[model samples]
Target: MGNSQRNDGVQLQDERLRGEQLRDEQLQDEQIRLRRPAGIRSLQLGDVKVTYVPDGAIRLTPRGWLPATTDDVWAEHAAYLDETGHLVASVGGLLVEHGDRALLIDAGVGPLSVPAEPGNAVGAIEGGALLASLAEIGRDPGSIEAVAFTHLHMDHLGWAHHPAPGTDGPAFTSADYLISEPEWTHRHLAEEHGTSEEMLAALEPRVRTVNDGDEIFPGVRVMLTPGHTAGHAAYVITGGGRRLIAFGDAMHSPVQIGHPEWWATVDHDTEQSTSFRRGLVEEMSRPDTIGYGMHFADVVFGRAVRGAAGEGARWEPVDA
Candidate 1:
């Protein structure tokens, strides 16, 4: 065959190979997307609207995630579990909308999933769809005025610090990153909890430290509820004659809603977690108030209600 013909054949083969590679990549992406959770399924309280944008979900051993819970509790709450028989922790963050501006309570574990780690002390998780869900809610990463991190943890700050491929930079480049003063001060200590010093360093430029009681934004106030971490803070957003408390990691599971004494194994201070949880349950039970348990698994957005017979409180999911 002529040299030109052979050259043309080679070029065609290369193009075909590239096309196949792109198709394979797209297929893999579709599988990941299908595995992710759906749109903003949540509620609104006055001017502020909260959506539980799913990044993904994690499956945890009953014994590891909620050490205090018995098999009976799991059996009772079986409706909340996925088919795998593990407790499905709906992995995502919260989008708090106020007028034209938006604020993210926490960044979900980014586009990465790890297998179950039985040997690890805390347990295992798999997630990474928060960005797409944010887009679904009509809020782009750049549109967020600030990303308020409750604590510096790998799962919570993954997307906040890292930009997805082909993105301009960190998602909220123009937005100020708000973190508690104590949280920022001892951010170094977060390394032990799976956060990297390098990531904290990357966040340093845009990071703005706020006092415990500082009203970070309109109708949004910071309330220091430390225990899970040395500087954990919950953002209380009040508007439209109602209040929503973004209780970040104060409690990991809904079972804690009923049994406030059962603290997560990952809690830095178990006693303090229980103490804060008790008061949280009480505060959440008050009229015209709702608690945003960032990691409460299926029952993420709920109002704590006290039983008429004084049987403590239970959660009622807020439907958006």
Candidate 2:
């Protein structure tokens, strides 16, 4: 072949390679951008409609993830933990609707992020989109009849106290915020752990205390599973003979489904939390029931099924 022909062929090949490279890069960028911004996961339980909305997420080192646990025990569950041995906890809320009324189980971590300090378990985390996610589902925060907090943690009260930017005020203006009486009385303790006074001030006026076993809503009963917090409560929404437990922070990581005794360091009462966790695991394994793990990243909702003996169990995500 002529030298010019050879050179021309080489130039065409180079151009084609460049084009393919550019296309590949664009595809990668699109994947990163369009990646689900981590919001809501909806499912229906007979007559009840449940949604797991994202506030954001937090990273907790295994050592910090379960304060009193040994590293060897965590090592056994490494697959469930990320590379850094950090557990990812979703920061958001659960929406339950039946008939015309809507109830938000927990307020998501508000639109805010903060770095961690020594001795603090929760690393960098940010969330502030609970209001927007609610709107997407055609439910206004004000339309929610009640804001039921699983515990008095900041992540659960974020947007409830701090409204999203440029928003009129607290989004759930008309909703009565509910918490356990013990949790309300010991609200000051949350501050020692990490909750801010500003958050408490914002929640004070709207916060209403409720006792255990109270029927906060139709078919929704409160089970005070205290340990993570003095007043941590899970809501069991029973309707049409089916139930879904919005088990807030009871077991942050689905990995906890396997290691119920490995309590998060942030637990106000680690021993009690572990005890409640064991009972919870058993209850979660029963039929016609599902669990809502607020901090459980992408798979926010699932069923805890019993596995071979010591292995405890596995999480089967529930999508409807």
Candidate 3:
């Protein structure tokens, strides 16, 4: 070969090698972003500050949890699965602070850990750091004005009724337990899921049933989007010209943004849940809105973006 031709060939080979290396690095970065659970993350919206307080995390068996999904689907999206092949989900509360007052959405899974059982959709689950997370933020449990629950699930009711670390009574004693009117009236149904009758009774004295559209807190309103449960509620907080929809369990994993039809095994009404999920994704895709998925692994706070032309929406994580 001519010397000039040889030089051109070598340059082309080096360019190809560099391109491959870059692609590999990009894939690795994407994997790291999806595989881990989130720590504490916060964002300021005008006068309101919203935070995702760390409690602990859980592993979900993808196939078992979302029964509609297939092995091929998971194989195509393996980056979402951890080393154990289960989806990593962070279990925590959304702390909304406005000036001196604070409102906590979902009290986390409390100070308990349950090991994964064979044939179960959920793998090992652990929680107990919510109180410590609050302390780290310099907010006392007593200062929280209300504990607004999306549903009566044990994970969302953690500190509301569970005794604080070593205390004899439940933490947040001074705060009213704000529950959706339907969720409170239909509390019995929650026992079928995971909530205990004892927990319901404990909250009876402090429970306050809130109606849809009620401004439970300043700049925060109740939005009833039931399907996962009889009364699953998503709180909408508006401040600083932007709004955040704290959609609890409405969409567990960001993967659902692309497949809203895949229902969790625990959903009360699969059809209703799927329908709501579709609309929720559309709303989250709006420019001025942010969605909070308490169990959305490391991307707990993100916005849904519509795909190019004919494609569906995808989740884009927002940095705190």
Quick one: best TM-score, which candidate?
A: 3
Number of the predicted model whose lDDT against the real structure is largest? 3
Cα lDDT of candidate 3 equals 0.90
Model 2, runs deviating above 4 Å: 1-38, 68-75, 83-85, 116-120
Q: Which lDDT tens digits does candidate 2 get at residues 111-185?
A: 887876666677768777777788787887778899999888877888888865667578887899999998899
Question: Order of candidates by lDDT, top first?
Answer: 3, 2, 1
Comparing 1 and 3 on lDDT, the stronger one:
3
Evaluation by lDDT, superior candidate among 2 and 3 = 3
Q: In candidate 1, what are the lDDT values of residues 173-247, reduced to their tens digit?
A: 667889999888888779987788778877888899987889876778999988889899999988777788988
TM-score, every prediction: 0.82, 0.83, 0.91
lDDT of 3 by residue, 1-320 (tens): 99999999999999999999999986676568678778889999999999999899989999999999999999998879999999998999999999999999999988888999999998999999999999999989889989999999888898888888678888796899899998888899999878998999888999999989999999999999889998899999999888999999898899999889989998988888999999999999998999999999988888999998878788888875
**What is the lDDT, from 0 to 100, of the residue 295 in candidate 3?**
94
lDDT of each: 0.76, 0.79, 0.90
Candidate numbers, best TM-score first, in rank order: 3, 2, 1
Candidate 1 residue pairs in clash (backbone atoms < 3 Å): 42-320, 55-129
Off by over 4 Å in 3: 1-30
**Least well predicted 10-residue stretch by lDDT in candidate 2:** 29-38
